[model samples]
Target: MWYVIQTQTGGEEELVGLIGKIISKEYYEECFCMNRECVRKTEKGQEIFLRPLFPAYIFVVTDHPKRLFLQLKRVPRLTRLLSDQEDSFFSVSEEEQIFLENVQNEEHIVQRSLVEVDDEGMIVKAYGPVGRYRNAIVRQRLRKRYVCIEQDFWGKKRKIYLGIRLREDGKG
Candidate 1:
């Protein structure tokens, strides 16, 4: 089962990590992961760096929803788990959970470029999350010219870095 646990602003990943540890201590055969971007300082000064494919959220897999909730409630920084009736827990689709996991575990390239796909199926270097659900390339900075994009699945968007593979026409 999957549940959306609401956490305090900017503490989503931390709360998720805490949940993972607590579950492990209890010997619960469950797993949890939060999609977060890692930012670092380089010769180019400070960069916004990577964006968590899915920020402010974490996907957890478990069988005992009640027990999970009970355990999760004690975790600090977590506001509450999103439920349907404020009592009934909400579960996420397996496919969606897996997708989140993949993004959390994959390696991506960091380019000063963004991915742009137009109505003509043309992919170009554009700026910002412009398309529906902010999937389009977002121009973050103009001076250093840094572009970042997170992969989008319909209405849901996740942080995804630029790909290294160039298109046949030298575009990505």
Candidate 2:
């Protein structure tokens, strides 16, 4: 099962590293934070960069949640494991996990998708993770090069923006 850990917004990477060192490998299968690819305009040209998909949250795959929780205390960072009102750790739903797994590659990065648009700027086709959820898109920002989709993540609604490379249909 996948569990979430909330920590300081800018300290996710450092905390993940600390948790890895403090916790035994037997307790958890994997620990990581998801990232999304973005295009940034630079003095030379457009550059691609990776940004955190879910800031302040880290996901862990573990069967032994109790052991992992206890071991996590040894890490110096301020962290909290997400849990229900009853205090039981909340695990990612199967549907949510599937969506995440599909969008992210082996490195856990959501790569920029390629989308084809018509002359009127209507999306004709999309290729990549964005394509899978094209119908669910809530907003499209072509100039900024991203499309936003809202999803229920662990009971909370979150709007996620995925980067895109647009091409005119039949032009490229």
Candidate 3:
């Protein structure tokens, strides 16, 4: 089962570091604080930096969400588990889970999608993380800066926004 934990927005990295001490690695397969590279234009210049995909939320994939939750509930900076009315354990919709799984590669880095646009500036297709779901793209940001995709998680449909860079000339 997987569970979502709400932690300090800018402190996820530190929270992970703190949790790493008392918990056993066997308790979970992943502790994901997903981030991706983003470019924003400033008066000075275009700045490139990593932005958290799911801010303040850490997703844990484990066979034992309850165990993991209980083990870390009181840990510093971790707020609460995203729970439902019934169970202490809550899982993301399957669709969302699938998307999350696909978002990250082996090193747990979310792929930075590269989009191809025709001379008319329309999105021809997307490469990288969204390569397989080109047709599923809901909105390709103006100038192909990002893409909004629809996904279903735990049966709820969601719109996910991902950053993309336009492909350079002569690049595949």
Candidate 4:
């Protein structure tokens, strides 16, 4: 099962490292922050970058949540585990976990999607993770080269923006 840990925004990487050192390997299978690939226009040319998909939150795969929680106390800058009450950690729902597992790659990065749009600025075809969840798209920001998708994350509705490279159909 995957458990969520909240920490300071922009401190996810450092917190993950801290947790790894404090927690025993037997208690957790993996600890990582999900990332998304984005294309940025730099002075040199187009550049790709990775950003946290869920800022301030990292995911840990563990069967023993109680033990992991206890060990996490020693980790500094960690906010708290996603829980309903004291000492009771909540794992992501099966549906949410499946969606996350499907969209992210082995490195836990959601790669930028390639999309083809018609003259009317409508997405005609999409490839990659975007293609897999086309119906979930709530807004298309073609000018910004991304789309906002509404997804149920951690039992709440979240609008996630994913990078997309758009090419006009019938043109090279």
Candidate 5:
């Protein structure tokens, strides 16, 4: 199961750094923080940066949430595990889970997609996670180099932007 853990908004990296030191060995290797590569505009030029895909949340894929939580509960900066009941946890909706899996490449890094749009401004083809949901794309930002995909997650329409080729020229 994939579990979401709540942590201080800007402190996810710090908390994740302590995982292996505090959590049980069985769960430590399975915990991860989700992030994505996106383009950012700077004074000099555009640069690529890695930012959290989901803010304030870190995902851990382990069957032992409670067992894992017991050891992690006291860690500083951690808020709580997303759960509805005591000692029990529920996973993100199936679709969201699948999205996470699809974004990751062979090395387990979430790859930044490179996409090309026609002169008419329609997405022609993409290579990476963004490609998988071309049909769901609702917005495109050539300046920012990301595409917004709106889809159903837990019965609600959640719109998220994934990083991609951020310009009309599709060049860095």
Candidate 6:
């Protein structure tokens, strides 16, 4: 199932990186980390490091949120799950999971990125412009649904959008 955890502000990259290491191979059947790479030039750079498009948030997959929560509690930087109560936790929808799967299966170019599939089997990718722009973004020409990333334009910072493009596929 899917779950949301509170990440320390500006600590999304560290959290997601930790999620990859903590969730093990035996648990591979039970959990996974949803990581997408965004390539941007650094100040002195002529290279690229795969950075998370979603900075302060990450999606992880596990069979039991309770078990996962306890393990995560010990992690130095993690705060809590995104819920009304401090301890209460939640899972993501199955539909969201499927969408993420499709994106991860797509391609990846340097400037472009792909929403990767983490073990939990959820679409945890920062959906909107950035997501859709990833070379790996999925496209179902027949359905006319663009499962890409794009900015929704709601947050104070610039919103990133990712999804498929129906119009571009000549479906419209």
- Model 4 lDDT, residue 58, Cα: 95
Q: Candidate 1 on 1-172: residue-level lDDT in tens?
A: 6666665556655676677665554524544444333335579854445444445655555677677777776766545666767557777766655554443343321233343445554445443222222344443433233334555442476544432221222434
Please provide, for model 2 over 20-73, each residue's C-alpha lDDT reduced to its tens digit, 9 standing for 90 to 100. Answer: 888889999999989999987789967889888999999999998878888888
- Per-candidate Cα lDDT values, in order, are 0.49, 0.88, 0.72, 0.87, 0.74, 0.46
Of the two candidates 3 and 4, the one with more favorable TM-score, higher being better, is 4
Q: What TM-score does model 3 achieve against the real structure?
A: 0.81
State the local distance difference test value for candidate 4. 0.87
RMSD (CA, Å), each prediction = 6.9, 2.1, 2.8, 2.2, 2.4, 11.5
Residues 22-46, model 5: lDDT tens digits:
7767864566677777767789877
Can you give the lDDT of residue 71 in candidate 4?
A: 79
Query: What's model 3's lDDT at 82?
Result: 79
Q: What is the lDDT of candidate 3?
A: 0.72
TM-score of each: 0.53, 0.94, 0.81, 0.94, 0.85, 0.48
Q: Give the higher-lDDT candidate: 2 or 5.
A: 2
Off by over 4 Å in 1: 21-33, 36-48, 101-121, 124-172
Comparing 1 and 2 by lDDT, which wins? 2
Query: Candidate 4 residues 1-172, lDDT tens each?
Result: 9999998899998888887887789999999999998877789967889889999999999999988888787776656888999967889889989989988999999988889888898988998888889999999988777898999887689988888987642222
Off by over 4 Å in 2: 168-172
For candidate 1, the 10 contiguous residues with the lowest summed lDDT are 162-171
